[model samples]
Target chain A: MDLKTLTIVVVVASFILYIAIAIWAKARSTGDFYVAGKGVHPIANGMATAADWMSAASFISLAGIISFAGYDSSVYLMGWTGGYVLLALLLAPYLRKFGKFTVPEFIGDRYYSKTAKVVAVICLIIISFTYVAGQMRGVGIVFSRFLEVEILTGLIIGMGIVFFYAVLGGMKGITYTQVAQYCVLIFAYMVPAIFISVQITGNPIPQLAFGSNLAGQDISLLAKLDEIVTMLGFNAFTAGSKSTTDLLFITAALMVGTAGLPHVIVRFFTVPKVSDARKSAGWALLFIAILYTTAPAVGSLARLNLINTIQPGEVGAVDGNLKYSDKPSWFATWEKTGLLTFDDKNGDGRIQYYNDKNESFKAKADSYGWKGNELKVDRDIMVLANPEIAQLPNWVIALIAAGGIAAALSTAAGLLLVISSSISHDLVKGIIAPEISEKKELFIGRVSAAVAILIAGYLGANPPGFVAQVVALAFGLAASSLFPAILLGIFNKRVNKTGAVAGMIVGIVFTLSYIIYFKFMHLELNNADNWWFGISPEGIGSLGMIFNFVVALVVSKVTEEPPQEIQDLVESIRIPKEV
Target chain B: MSSKENREAYWKANLKLMGLLLSIWFIVSYVLGIVLVDQLNTIQFGGFKLGFWIAQQGSMYVYLILIFVYAKKMNTLDKKYGVED
Candidate 1:
């Protein structure tokens, strides 16, 4: 089959499979709707958690970010996966033992303050909304690009799929569907990676091929990549470009944020026992690691392949670059998206894709009669275009579309669940209508989920940034606001209601303001040099978390201690118990 | 069910285990990947600068091991305290 037909078939098939799962696993009660009846096996929950955790950022854009950013992209690689350790060891089992329906319920009960619960709900909405927007955006892009539909049309379709499963089956449906999604996405991701690895390095294991010497060459792949990128006035692939402080804090922020994310944490609540929660996290990371380890290989190899495509021969040679007229079909395909562009500067028919901003390369470029770099390749296209760049078969290209949609829809459904439950469970039932019936609660949950998806679809149509950057902000906010509070709630028993509320406000406000100032209000101050203490805006959340910790500790010391019942609540959550 | 003293002991053991595992987590990802990256990069291993490998690949492997270890240790602890629900 041709590319377009195969893409439509695979994507439609996956959606049909998900809808079937939703029908089969429809929730019958509040228990099933909230926690999948707490019967999910550890391994199955692990797979679901993996699918829940690996969003569009993980499936579509992580490798692309790594492909272009080179060594600095380790912030994403380590930061994202390492958080599983925190979840398994520090948070997951305890939260599972708490047996709450939502994160705010735990905060409310543990702090013994409705005010604290309300604050937690607000933070959860903001973080989840920011994250869901990126997933919705990914859905729109994959549909528009693969199916030749408008972005809004794609978004509405994506929202409809989410509403079907999420509103009907809740966590029960999402769990089984996510297990299916994890299989589809991981298969889709690894197949192309293995093929490309064999194509480039004469090895099938992408991880090993990353370290292996290029075929028919003595130099290592990283060494060759370093040499070529440096020649084009870019940093070596082996060396990171961001300042050290920023890298440290950025990685830390992402790690802590991953542990703190409500969507991922709630996955643990679906499992049967506390021990199951602990083991399930390990399984989830193992699954996630399969993709994580393979990503860097896919990244560096794609970088090498792209350069080889652009410059068919030696780098500095006059006749080395591929002529514009001889460009491949893949190049033309991406050019239609405006993501890849070629201008014939100096009237040269060949494409020159070097760093035009490099001062020293200017003279050499002028000597070669080259005016400026004439090709603009968007980083996002790296992964989307990788299979074609390597000449992989049509079926594999179609699988990439299926995988991206699975990833986006799974995560969006998860986040929207969190949003809806926060409203129906935490807001409506917990606060506004404490006397509401179970059926009414379910009705509110379904209604809120539908409403949330519509808002998310609108945001997806107009994302502030690409999938990964928007996710980075969500992580930063979660790190600053939620992680600190939850960690203290579990580890330290003395944190009072006033202290927790004060700490959360300080964290969310400080992190949000710093991010906004640099990201939107004053873009000039967003870089490493201008950053406070050499920590970029992306890394500033660690500082905000620290401020929250210090402020909470000081305030708790001066104020009245938490009530005895709240202390017992903390102690109860620490140990495993039967429901 | 366990006595107050047994429960306290179990919680303490959990804290101690978490502290040790988290320390390893911090040293590998934060220390090896960042603060000591330049120093470690001087030593090459398996076609990678030590720091770069630790940052991208090595730290993730360690994280995986840490979770499994924590889970296994917690299981035994749960059994010891009769808290394996």
Candidate 2:
């Protein structure tokens, strides 16, 4: 079948599947809505968490970033996965033992102050909204590309699907649907990766394929990719050029941020027991690792394939590589999306894809009668364009499109649910109207979810930058603010309301202001001119987290300990037997 | 020690297990992946360098194993401490 027809079929099938799950898992009570009735099997919850955790960034952009940025991008892989260790070890079991419906609930009760809860709610909103915006944009991109619809149209359709399920099923329906999404997305991701790996390295496992020798070549895949990219003026694929300190801070920020994210932490609350929460985190990581391990392989193989396809022979051939006239159909198709663009800078009909940034390489291109870099490859296109790059079956390509949309939509739905719940349940019911009825609260939740979707859709329609970069900002904010506060609130009984609230405010303000100043406001002076302590805005959040820890500790020491009742609450949360 | 003191000793051992695991957590990623990466790079694994491996893949695999290890060991500790859940 044609790609368009196959894409439409996949979309319709996925939509039907989602609606069915939502209807089947329709939440009956506030408990069902908030914590999936707290009966989710560990493995099932693991699968759902993987789907929720992967999001559009993991499914679509992670491999792409690695493929292009090479070793400098290792920060993303380590940071994201490392956070799960923190979650499993430090936070999950205790949070589960706390037996709370939401993260804010744990904070409020632990700190013995509604003010702490309010700060947490605000942090949650900012972090989740920042996160949801990226997911919404990812949904729009996938929809527009595969379904041949306008970006806004795709976003609206995405919103409608999320609204139908999230409004009806809440976390319960979302969890089941996420399981289905996990299957689709992982299958979609692996099939193309496996095909490419086998094609390149005669290996099926992407992780091993990366280290294994390339087909018809004695060199390993990474070795070959390193040789090729460096030959083209790019740094060796396995070597990092970024400052070690910066990379360290970014990795730290991402790890803490992952632990701090409200959506992920809240997932632990869905399990039935404290031990199950601990086990579920391990299971979730195991599931996530399936994709994470494969990601580097995909990145390396795709980078190799991309270089090979564009160059099509040994570099510096006198007769020149294949003409632009002979470029693959995939190239033309992606070019239409503006993700892959080509300009015959020298007015020669041949395309030269190389590092225009490297002076030495630029000299070689000039010596070889090549013009300025002819290929302008956007990183986002790498995953979307993978199937076509491998010349895979049309259905696999269609499946990838569907999978990408599933990844984006599933995460957007999850984020929207959390945002709506924080507003309707935490802020409105818990604080504003403590006497609100369950029915009224449920109504507010549904309406707020729909409205949140609209706002996310608007942001996605006009995204600020790369999806992953925007997500990094979200992670930075969460790491500095929510993670520290939550960690202290759970583990340190002396972390009174003053400490918790002050920590969150200071952390978020420091991180957000650093980002705004460096990334937006101070850029007019040039990037090199502005940063504080030589820390880029991307890594400054780690400094903010440090500040948060210090302030929280100092404030806690100065302030009275939390009331005895709150101290007992903390002790109860720490002991699994109580729950 | 009295039987009550023996029970307290068991609890202390469990806490000690947690302390050890937590220390490993800080050391492996923070110390190896970040602080000692350059020094570790003096060592090699396969064709790749050790620091690169830790930053890219090694730490993650270790993290996975650490959780299972923590869980398994903690289960034994829980039983000893009469705190199994």
Candidate 3:
């Protein structure tokens, strides 16, 4: 069969498998629907969390972002995976010992206030919605590129799949399906990486190849990449251009936010015991690290391959650039998707791919008769186009398409579950109608899930802004608001309901206004110079988290202490054994 | 010791363990990976600059180890305190 036919078969097979699992493990009660009956084995929960955590951002855009930004993107590499350490050490076991169905439940009970639960529910809703939007966009990208469908059509199809499982199986169904997705995505990611590693560095392991010499060449890969990119006026591949302070703050914000995310924290609730929670976090990070470690290698290798393909000879030489007619089949293929475009600025009928915006490079470019950079490549296309660029087999290309969809759908389903549970369990049942029956609550959960999918699908069709930037905002919100409240609730017994509530309000409000004023209201002034303390909007959450810590401490000191029962509750969660 | 005294001692030990482990965690990723990156980059490690390798690869490995070690140590502490489930 041809590539298109084969891609359809693989993608369809995966979908059918997921639907079957959803049916077989369909939720029977609110217990199963919300927390998988709290019976998930540690290892299974770990695999599911890995799939739920590595969204379209990690599978599709991350390598591309790393490739273009070079060493400056280490913030993502370390920031994302390092958060698991915080989750494992600081949060997971205690939350599991609390044995709650949702993150907001713990906050409400610990703070002894209905208002605190409501505040947490709102934060969860905002963070999950912002996050789910990015996943929908990922689904659209995969569908449009591989399945040759319109973005809206792709999103509708994605919504249909998520609605069926998420509405029916709830957390139980999502968990099993996610386990399958983790297998599919990791296989799809590694196969191409291994092939490319062998092709470029004669090494089977991409991580080893990252630092090793190119095949039959004496110079190491990073050194060669640095040489080529610098010659083209781009920053060195192994050196960072971002200030150290910005990197520090950005990395910390991402770490804290990852730990604070409701979707991630809820996964720990599915485990059977407190010890299992810590063990599963370890397993989840190990599985996630498999992909995280390989990403930088894939990024650098892809960058090196792209530059060699574009400029086959000396950088400044007139005959060096590839002729338009001689461009590779992959170039033509990606160009049709409107993601990769070429412009003959000098009408030279050849490609010039360089940093033309570099002031120092402009004089040399003029001397070479090059009008400007003639190629524009979107960063999101790097991983999706990698197999084609490397001339890998057609099957590998098909696998990547399925893998991208799986990553996006898995995370989207997880977020939708969180959003739905927040509305049905936290809002309607916890506050609005405390006397509701379990059966009625389960029905509400399913309906809300379906509605959330529809809303998420609509947003996917009409994305609010750049997917990465929106995702950063989601993390910042989670870090500033939920993380501090949840951390204080468990770690500090002195923080009263009023203190916790005030801290969350101050943290989220301050962070949101700062982001809006800089990012949306004053777009033209959203640079490093205009930022407070040289911190970008992306890194502002770290400072907000600090503010939350300070406000909670001071406010609690000035007010009455938390009741004795609340202190007992805090002491109870700190231990592994149930009293 | 009374049950309350046992609980307090276990909590104190847990705090001590966390402080030590968290210190290592901070030093690996934040100190070596970011703060001292420029100075460490002068030292090469096979195919990588020492700092870049630590940031992208070494810190992650250390993070994995830190979690497992904490878990193992906590398990022992729980058993010793007669709190194992």
Winning candidate number (lDDT): 3
Model 1 lDDT per residue over A1-579, tens place: 888998999999999999999999999987788889999999999999999999987888888889889889999999899989989988899999998789999888888889999999999999999899988988998899989999999998999999999999999999999999999999999999999988888889998898888888898888889898888877788787788888889998988899999999999999999999999999999999999999999999999999989988776688888899999999999999998999998776899988888898888777777788999988877789899999999999999999999988999999999999999999999999899999999999889998999999888987765445657788889998888888899989999989999999999899999988888788876776677899887888889999989988889989999989888888888889632
For residue B28, model 1's alpha carbon misses the true position, in angstroms, by 0.6
- On the 0 to 100 scale, the lDDT of residue A339 in model 1 is 83
Model 1: per-residue Cα lDDT at residue A89: 86
- Can you give the DockQ of every candidate in the order shown? 0.72, 0.46, 0.77
Q: After superposition, how far is residue B11 of candidate 2 from its true place, in Å?
A: 6.6
Clashes of each: 0, 0, 0
Q: Is the docking of candidate 1 incorrect, acceptable, medium or high quality?
A: medium
- Candidate 1 runs further than 4 Å off: A464-469
Q: Candidate 3's residue-wise lDDT over A343-435, tens digit each?
A: 999998999999998999889888889998999999877799999999999999999999999999999999999999989999999999989
Q: Please, what is the TM-score per model? A: 0.98, 0.95, 0.99
Task: Write candidate 2's Cα lDDT for A474-516 as tens digits.
Answer: 9889889988888887667788889888988999999988887
| Model 2 bad stretches (over 4 Å) | A464-469, A524-529, B1-15, B34-44
Q: Distance (Å) between predicted and true CA of A381, model 1?
A: 1.5
Model 3 residue runs over 4 Å out of place are A466-468
